[model samples]
Target: MIAVMLEILGSALLGLGLAAAAAVLLAHRLPARRLVLLAGGIGALLGAYVTHEALGPGHVLVTLLGSLGVSAVVVSLLLRPAAQAAAPAPAHRAVP
Candidate 1:
């Protein structure tokens, strides 16, 4: 339907614009351009998915899974790298 198509197009454009704006703002503060881009991309993808799912008829589990997947992607990307970076390296021990 034309209405559905228009809705999707609108949401997609909004998602892209918001994501770009977020990434640009983050890039100003964050040194890792890649990480900010990753965050923005994930956010946009998730937003689009949520919009589509909300507009269409879908099962509850499917929506929940989609949302959960998005959350996992974002949380992992943001936290895992920082955790790895924060861990202290073990000191070299001389063999007896």
Candidate 2:
């Protein structure tokens, strides 16, 4: 049903969003942008899968795998690159 599909997709998107936020929080201490990006992607994937499984009517394995894959791809492509690019700005000092 369309409703079911919508629910699943919506949940997945929400999860992905949350994961990106979490990753940003974790990124603060991390030195490697790649690692942060990767971590964010993983977090997003987990979020998407959990969201989908909680709302969708599917087998546990299917739900987990499907959501994980979907979330991973979406978050990795959409969020990871962008997040990784953001670096702390250097403090400006007065010119001698």
Candidate 3:
């Protein structure tokens, strides 16, 4: 059980790192959400392939879905603050 948990955790972190790096590289060319989604999707497919090769064919779908979810969450957590910081401040209105 502990080994399984560790594997999942490791997979998630690996997916998160890969997605985050891709998103960063694509940040200037795409919207934050779109970049994140694209990166996460790519990470999912890659993770699935790796897991299938490493752990056999039975685990591909599960690892793909898990990596997708983990990547999305990590990307959002990473980019949200940066988005908020980059947003323009609201303009002040003149008093009536």
Best by lDDT: 3
Query: Superposing every Cα of model 2 onto the true structure, what RMSD results?
Result: 11.0
User: How does model 2 fare in lDDT?
Assistant: 0.53
Model 2 C-alpha lDDT per residue in residues 24-45, reported as the tens digit of each score = 7646444455554554456545
Give the 10-residue window scoring lowest on summed lDDT in candidate 1: 75-84
* Candidate 3 residue-wise lDDT, 1-96, digit = tens: 554555456565666566766576756544565556565655554555555456754464566566666565545554533333466888999999
Work out the TM-score per prediction.
0.38, 0.33, 0.39
| Alpha-carbon local distance difference test for all models | 0.50, 0.53, 0.58
Estimate, for each residue in 1-96, the C-alpha lDDT of model 1 and write its tens digit: 564454445443444444455456544444465655555455545754784567564343344344445534453454322223466889999999
Off by over 4 Å in 2: 1-28, 57-96
CA error at residue 35 for candidate 1, angstroms: 7.7
lDDT score for residue 81 of model 2: 34
TM match of model 1 to true structure:
0.38
